[model samples]
Structures are given as C-alpha cells and as structure tokens.
Target: MGLKYKYESTSRRDTKELARNVRPGDRLYVIHDVSQVVAPLEDAQLYSEFIVTKDKAPFTGTPMVCSASAHRQVGGTSVTSLLVRYGEVYTERPVGIRNIAEEPPLLPEFQHLAARVAREHAADVAVARSEAASSGRRRWF
Candidate 1:
C-alpha cells in the first residue's frame, strides 16, 4: 500500500481539556516528522557527497562552525542538518526506502505512561474518544 499522510487539527480548548484530564503517568504520544515539514538540504547534500565522493566538505570537517554559518545564511537552524553534516560516517548500509507506516509503536516509557493515564482517566477517555469520533476527523489510519 502507498503511504498516506494523516493530518490532525486540535483546538486550544480541546488541548487544554486533554491536558487537564491527563494524570502523571498518562501515556502521551507526540507524533511528528520534522523532515516531512522541513528539508535538511545542506546536510543531505553534505552527506551524499562525503559518502559517495570520499571527500569531506569544509562544513563536514568543522560542523559546529559550519552549522552556525549555515543557519545564519538559511535563516534557521536544524538539528537534522547539523547531524548529517557533522556526524561520524556509518559503516552500515542504508535501508531501502518504504512506505511510511501507520500507528508506529510508542516508546516503552510512553506506553507505560499512556496505560496509566488511560486507566486513571477512563471516563475522560470515553469523553475524549467520543469527541474525537464525533468531530469528523479525516482518518488516514
């Protein structure tokens, strides 16, 4: 199956309600893809050339200095770009690209927190679930 991008919009009211309802151990899953929103072009280019051409770009040699300068030029700083530019070269082969997976598993810590929160706010879950279901969200899952 092809990758389907899912977009969710939450109002401030809804977010506040959720936050208020949340318990200490409640599991929170914050799903995001920085690369999808912002391309780390400089980093990508730097790595591609370094790996394929077997030569270090000036930026690759002194990543901190290069990143500071790049950020000034680009008008934004990106950690992904910095890592790609300055990170140690990996010996492992890159995995082949595939369709983005839906419902990727939450981290163990998050899962535990979620379970605890869900249990504590069972009533809230029903309410939230009902609201979510009724809100007519465009589902990609």
Candidate 2:
C-alpha cells in the first residue's frame, strides 16, 4: 500500500480536479492537454506524468539549471502520477532544481553568520584548552 495524492496542473483548475479524484484505472499522462482519457480496465497499471519548467534570465558566469532531479515511481505494474511543483516561470533558462549549498544567505544581520560561527568555535576551543590546563594533566589508569 502507498500514500494517495492530489495533483494539479498549474494552468487549469478542471485538470486539478481530475487529478484529485482520479481512479485506480486512469490514464493520467497528458490529462493536462486532453483531460478526459480513461485507462483500460484490463490494464493493471496506470500512467501519469508532469513537467515543471522554471527558466531564469541569462547569465555570464555559471549555468543555473542543474537538475530536473525527479523520481519516477511510475511503473508497468504500478500507477504513475507526475505533479510538477516548481517555481512556475516560463523562461529561456529554467531556474528550477537547486542544492542546499546554493541557497542564498540569510537576511540582514544573519548574513554574516558564517564568520561569527568560526569566531565562536575558536573561542570554544580556547576555553576548553584553558580549563584542561587548569585541571592538570590526567593519568591514564
């Protein structure tokens, strides 16, 4: 058994409704384009597919669009559904899919947090060393 879901087309409300109430034997691949295709009852597997296009403005240094990094839980013996959860911007360069290291810095005072962290870590090490010296050397049993 698996978790059932509600999916949607970013442009259409009717297709969104279709996704929410889809049956086990439903052909959901291109429901966004043609919203009324049903699956053959004889067929045990179901099919669904979705695409999320997020294009950013052009850049000079690095290519931004890294991964459409998606999972294909879709299979022949199983039902397939693709729900595109993206930035939803149509552009020449798709800006979707980013890693955690690519995240922008926090706002305002927290922007310099990395430097502060390094300083704090240095202070902690110094404090630990001083305490150890004062406590005297330990003799291993």
Candidate 3:
C-alpha cells in the first residue's frame, strides 16, 4: 500500500519534486494569517503558541510565539508541503531541538483555576460519552 497525494496545481511533477527535496529537520514557518480561524489546534495551539517555540524559546528570530506545533518527535516533508498550501515557508536553517521540563508548580490561584477547568472538561466528556453510548454510537471513552 502507498500513501496518496493530492496535487495542488497543474505542475504535479514539480510538486513531486518539491516533496522529494524536503528533508528532516527542515525548519518551516506558518505564513497563513490565522486571524479569522477559530480552531484551537491550528490557531491557539499549533501556529500561534506551539509550532514556533520549544522549551519557552522561539525557533528563530521571530516576533510571534506559537506552541504545541510538534505533535510528534518526527514530522514528514509531506506535512511541510501541506502547510505550504496554506502559506508556510521552509527555512534553510534546521530547527533547533530543546528539552521540555515536566509541569512546574503554579500559584495557588492558578492551581485552583486549573482544577476547576479540568473538572468541567471531565464532566463535559462524561456527558458526551454517555450520550454516545445511549445512542449506540462508537464509544469514544
């Protein structure tokens, strides 16, 4: 079995060449203006808060700070091309890797707030799971 690729333009050969030339550790930046996007995975998390930083440091000399971009230890060049379709740029310099520390202590107020948020989310998930189970849908839990 082979992975399928969707061509973005008439130049399918050129696109294939571009994907072939991509290598591991090739740094890329998201250029898509996500100002209007509401999804957290792409907007609040990946492009804005997670993708551009590791261990609290920026990938390079850039202004915007993003987080949670690297969902895995290794990503493919195909992902880079996919992002390019949405206006991202590949950098010549390889991305620097850093070690992330375990969760540190927070202020008492913050801890309380975190606990509340966790409880609320758990309740929401439980409700959703119950609804799904009753409806004979797939059990997400």
Per-candidate clashes come to: 3, 5, 6
| Residue lDDT tens for model 3, 15-113 | 454344434333434333434356332332122212322222134212222323555643222433444454433333213322132233465768889
- lDDT per residue (tens digit) for residues 55-138 in model 1: 223452311112121223221212223233333222232233211332344767689899988787887767777777899763
lDDT of candidate 1 vs native? 0.32
**Which ranking of candidates, highest TM-score first?**
3, 2, 1
RMSD of 3: 14.7
The lDDT of each candidate is 0.32, 0.35, 0.41
In model 2, where do residues sit more than 4 Å from their true spots? 1-79, 84-93, 96-101, 133-141
Error in Å for residue 137 of model 3: 0.4
Q: Which residue window of length 10 is worst by lDDT in model 2? A: 60-69
In the predicted model 3, the residue pairs found to clash are 48-66, 49-66, 49-67, 50-66, 50-67, 50-68
Mind giving the per-residue lDDT tens digits that candidate 2 earns over 46-74? Answer: 22232322222233211112222235322
Consecutive 10-residue window with the lowest summed lDDT within model 1: 45-54
